[model samples]
Target chain A: MMNEQRREFIKKTALGVFVGLGAASGLVPAFSLEKTALPVWDEKPVPGKIRWGMLIDTRKCKEGCQQCVAACHHEHNVPAFKNRREEIRWIWKNSYKNVFPTADNAGASKEIQSRTFLSLCNHCADSPCTQICPTGATFKRWDGIVEIDYHRCIGCRFCMPACPYGSLSFNWQDPRTAIVDPVTAYPTREQGVVEKCNFCSDRLIKGLQPACVEVCPEQALVFGDLNDPASDIRVLLESNVTMQRKPELGTKPSVFYII
Target chain B: MKSRKLLWLVTFAAISLFAAFYLFSNGEAETPQKPLARVSVVDSTKCIAPKEFMRANHMQVLHGWERSVVRDGDRVHIASNGSRFQKSLGTCLGCHNNRLFCFSCHSYANVKPKCWNCHLSPMETQ
Candidate 1:
């Protein structure tokens, strides 16, 4: 019995020394992370795996609230022109009648009928802009985002006309002179090139939400992977019957409106 | 003959005066016309490359970064020293702006980079 007690004492003393040494220095990590497992972010957009999409809950989006539109334009350094004709817009509002031509009914609710639908690049799956681009400057990514390579774009404005949604805005003059206080380091577009909403592709690379979506006070915008069944956008689409602008064209627009 | 000699001397004096004015006026101005840089002193850790290297070949490096970012879609630049950086005007322009750092050498060289046509310098914004 004495030998067993002595053995226990030695074991306790060794454990105490081990614990004391561990406490003296952080030899053992407090968080207890697995050394073998390296945390890999790799959030960068990969083609064919993630099809990013958005659902605008129109009910939550207040009329005359141009927050989303203004935020996008500001973030991208989109020019503001005095004349309506010369103005460049990445996102803007249009009446329900204009956005959904065939769907508008005389008997429909006045609230939705008169509602201003936020519009931008549809980022079509089978984008007509990509198909029409002579220089292959406007090409659709495998993840279904239609992006414009300004370097390659000859500024022929072929993609401008091809887009049925009228999302593309051409910079008629140097955009730098227009913005009074440009967003620092944001690229101001040169004259003659067509620019449009890229769905915040730059932000997406760093795993950040779109500026428009982030600025919306009403939480109207829901952006996520359309392919991911568990994504908020997918769940929203499943729960609510959403509508896409001019769906009959079969461009497979990534944006959905919950009207 | 003295009158003709005086006339030639006066003409030479006027020509020299004009030449001096042009030479002095065209030289690099000590005080930059644009807004001053936000910070004056730069530490070695402040920049990715040494100041000498950046001053010499920033254009080439920037163009390469632009191609990788805009065309090839490689946004993040990982340095050999294991530092990761996102290649955008916003990143560097946050500190070393056009008015102070960029134009100091650029205006002196009389080379107009097309970067201003697209990217907004902090001075333009303010």
Candidate 2:
């Protein structure tokens, strides 16, 4: 009996010491060593299996088609407004100079005046938007996809000014009233909230291509895991002279464009 | 007795004055003059339908556009000529352009049909 009481006392004293140490160091509350396993879903992308990315082959992309843009808007239920001020876009085409200003200026001596390119969220490995967001609403997932949780956004617009690519947008008006029947694929955002491209996280979970990728007739868009040397994106990176947006900013964007 | 009464009255007045000042100042400090945020309300009754259509698609209208039209219930009415309408976008742009708030999504969606296609994009692409 006495031995058992001594053992109990020792255990209680040890636990108290651990808790005190944790509190002093600001570590999480101490708990027992028993490991609790999380339930695994059959469809869950094996935690690090797929790193979503995009490669734009400007050579194959036809100017003015805007098919990718239409498909993305249609799928996401983006509103169409007549006023330029009320317009919203996820992906759009720009003149070669717009997409690649540095390269375009360098190529001014060359003969191609009609060269055009597509631009969207670069989904950088070192994303500035994620760092600047006061609320952790914007974040990069484990698989290298930058995403936003609309619920946590406070509409501070700090991320807007921080982003060099101008990929973010704020809901000046309540978005619920804009569309006939808002697309139910994703939750609609409220007024005074900021939003941006999430690389279509919902579609990725289903093992499907991004809306833009599915609709590109010219096959100008490529999506894959960049970490794997065997992946198609990796192969393309090896073969093509592709460049990222704003390398000087050191964002290291996953989206690459072949010149 | 008179001196005692005067001292007591002076003390009471001082106490009352301090209490009043504290109460009023605290009340004013606690009540914010401007709210942290202002959500625009839609006036549905004053909304104007598109000229081509009797009613504009719900998505086509700006936020707070239909607030004036909302009656006792969910039902709303629109003007026959589709000319005069209250709009949240208009109110928002009174101080700033809609491009700051809308362009990223508009460009992403690529739904530029009427004014968007013809008007200059705010984004200064090279």
Candidate 1: residue B15 lDDT (0-100): 100
Query: TM-score for every candidate vs. truth?
Result: 0.71, 0.54
lDDT of 2 by residue, A22-103 (tens): 2233232222111111111122122334456899987788867889987876667565655666555667777766666555
The number of the candidate with the highest lDDT is: 1
Residue ranges of candidate 1 with Cα displaced over 4 Å: A1-45, A104-107, B1-46, B50-56, B94-98, B122-126
lDDT of candidate 1 over A127-231, digit per residue (tens): 779877888888776456788876677889988888989999887777767875566525667887888999998666545799999999999999988877788
- Best model number under DockQ: 1
Best by TM-score: 1
lDDT of 1 at A81: 88
Clashing residue pairs in candidate 1 (N, C-alpha, C atoms within 3 angstroms): A188-B118
- In TM-score terms, candidate 1 sits at 0.71
- Fnat values, one per model, are 0.13, 0.00
